[model samples]
Target: MTTFHDLRSRRRDLLDDLGELEDAFAEVTAALDEPSNDDEDARAEQRRHRAWLERQRAGLLVVLSETERALLEFGADGWDDP
Candidate 1:
């Protein structure tokens, strides 16, 4: 069984990781929005990267959601103000 402190730490880490992922996702999206060459291969590669990033972001979101729910159930343990 994980301690409340451990869960709090995990939640903080997950939130930080999610923020970084979101930043990266935004950058990739911006790159995709820019005009590019007509080469189908290059376009396909960019699309693949975008898709992969989207999947990563989705997975991180799910984990973050789970972590938050667990933390909520565990209570704030005086770590937070009511």
Candidate 2:
């Protein structure tokens, strides 16, 4: 019995997480392009962050689907079953 507002809030949180991860990735890219490959540890850290982002991305998809369903259900006029 989740409400529309609840689903919207959850979707917002997921989008916020995605934006934060994108910013973190920019930092990783900056570190990687330092004109030297002497930071294997940094590269490894970047890989880990990217993997985490991938998992988050997948999770966002599910949230998006849920939000879409909620919107549709709430907006469907005369959806009451006979």
Give me the candidate number with maximum lDDT.
Answer: 1
After TM-score superposition, what is the CA distance of residue 36 in candidate 2 from its true location, in Å? 3.4
On TM-score, the candidate that comes out on top is 1
Residue 74 CA displacement from its true place in model 1, Å: 1.7
Tens-digit lDDT track of model 1 for 1-82:
8776776787788778878878887887787788976588877887888788788879988987877677778775663322
Provide the clashing-pair count of each candidate structure.
0, 0
- Give the alpha carbon lDDT tens digit for every residue of 1-82 in model 2: 8886776676677667778877876776776667766777877877787778767777777877777677677786532222
Clashes of 1: 0
Error of 2 at 5 (Å): 1.5
- The Cα error of candidate 2 at residue 43, in Å, is 1.9
The stretch of ten residues in a row with the least summed lDDT in candidate 1 is: 73-82
Estimate every model's Cα lDDT from 0 to 1.
0.77, 0.70
